[model samples]
Target: MDEIIQEDKKVFLYLNNLGDPSFDQLWMLISSTWIWVPLYIIFLYFLYKNYQLRSLVFILIFLALGATVSDQLANVFKYGVARLRPCHDPSLEHYMRIVKCGGQYGFYSAHASNTFFLASYLGILLKKKIKWFPYAIFVWAIVVSYSRIYLGVHFPIDVLVGAFAGSLLGVIFSVLAQKVINKQKITP
Candidate 1:
């Protein structure tokens, strides 16, 4: 465990040091949730175009529930694991760039969790409808996850764990959504 942690720190430092001041603003903007509102609206447009009214409502509900679950679950892990974020770590404080600092604990990042959850859930739900969607959304999720690292707020392990957990939740919720839609006989 100690060796793994050391490796995680090494990786985090390598990635975090790659940032330049010129790109900091771009990454900060990308890291902001509100900056993605237009993207979310575009996602809604895709959902609206693909699914019927009743099915779309159920899908949206599942998305909300899945996002909530992903975020809260990450919070649970953050506090429960008690892992210090890179910016908040005393040892790394001087070594790291600290472009943006978040809370003390960052065992797993909620931002990564939420974004990956959306990517996984919507990718599965809309794969057949829009062939390129899954690829595009997964790429988006990767970029978002990387932003957390670039900002020095999360280690690679934190983002990786969050992505894994979020993807699991996405699959679970997508299955449930499909079942409910089928039971209600709502065609998409």
Candidate 2:
């Protein structure tokens, strides 16, 4: 396992250091939260105004669950696998941006996981009222995941896995919430 991780790190170092200025610039542009904050506010306002209080509460609970699950899963993978980040590996030392150096193991990105989870959970909840919500969520997830890679804090694979794991958790929570809502008989 250690040998495989080392080999993967070597490959990532070579690929991630392509040093394309345009790519870097694009990444920087997408990574800014100025765009995300407005979108978040709009979504929150819509949810608060359009949805019933119970539904809003359920969605918030599911969002929290998704975030918690993502965090715990990231910690488990980071410690259990013990893979080193590109910035931390001596072989990849020259390739790193240095400023974005993070923890030793970067197998899974918490940022990507958390953002993706929130996006997926909210996207599902808002799918009917806002037809474009899912697309926006997907775009947000992609941008967030790309930021992790562009900042030299995580490899592409790490972000991809984090996104996938987060999406799964979001779906699970959504389904559970639906079940609970259906089982309970609400009075009109």
Candidate 3:
């Protein structure tokens, strides 16, 4: 286990050293919540305007719940694992410009997790009207995950695990939320 981890770290370092400043700048710009938040709100507004009120309510609730759960889970992993961010890790070779060394652990990226959860939740909700929703979600997920790497904060595996974990959490929460709503309808 230790050997495998060490090898993975070596790979992460190698990849981190290949960063391009231009890509890093682009990643930083796109990953900003200032841009994505308005976009998210616009999407929700469109859904509310075009879809049934009940559906809009349910989807918005589920999306909020999914985001909260995903964020907490990522935080738990970060504190529990207590791994150092690549920018802070002396063992890793750094080449990219460091915006800031985030929390102590880089085992899983919070940005990746949160964006992935949002993407998955929205994709599921909008699956019917937009055939391309899933693809767009995937593109966003990849970009958000890669931004951590480009910023010299997270390792590739960290981003990958975060994406997987967040997606799973989003799906689970959506199903759970739907079930709860169904039960409430049946009872009252």
Candidate 4:
């Protein structure tokens, strides 16, 4: 486990060092929630388009709740694992170029968790309607996840675990959302 973890750090540093100052702002924007307003609006539009007002309300509420759960779960892992972020780690502090250092712990990134949670949720929700949509959603999730490492705040493993956790949470929540929809008898 220790050797594998050491290799993961090596991979993290390699990926983190791949960033250039010229593209920092672009990545920072991608990693930011504020910049994703349009995407959220689009999601709302899709929900509204597919369901009646009451069903939309239930879907939106559960979606938000699921996202919150995913984010909070990552936070728990961060504090529990107590792993220092790459930017905060002493051994590699000098070797990396970081634009945003962010919080002290980076065991599993909330950004990765939240984005992938929404992606997986929305992706699976809309999978039947749009044939190719789920792939696009997952691609978007991966790019956003990569942005965290580019900003030098998270390790590769951090994002990987986050992706996995968020994906699982997403599937779980989507199932819950489906149950709510079924109980409510929401027809798309």
Q: Each prediction's Cα lDDT score?
A: 0.95, 0.74, 0.75, 0.88
* Candidate that beats the other on TM-score, 1 or 3, i.e. the better one: 1
TM-score ranking, high to low: 1, 4, 3, 2
Clash pairs of candidate 3? none
Q: Candidate 4 residues 1-188, lDDT tens each?
A: 98988998899889989899999999999999889899889878877776788777777887989998999999999999999999899988888888899889999989889888988888888888777878887898999999999999999999999999999999998888888888978776
Best by lDDT: 1
In model 4, which runs have C-alpha deviations exceeding 4 angstroms?
none
What TM-score does candidate 1 get on C-alpha atoms?
0.98
lDDT of 1 by residue, 1-188 (tens): 99999999999999999999999999999999999999999999999999999999999999999999999999999999999999999999889899999999999989889988999899999999999999999999999999999999999999999999999999999999999999999989
Residue 5, candidate 2: Cα error in Å is 5.0
lDDT of 2 by residue, 1-188 (tens): 66866666665665566557657766665665576678778878878876777777776786677778898999899988787777787776776664367789987877788778877777777788789878988887887787777667787778878888888787888777766656664211
Evaluated at residue 169, the lDDT of candidate 3 is: 80
CA deviation > 4 Å runs, candidate 1: none
Best by TM-score: 1
Model 2, backbone clash pairs (residues 3+ apart or across chains), number: 0
Clashes, model 3: 0
Cα RMSDs, all models: 0.7, 3.2, 2.9, 1.1
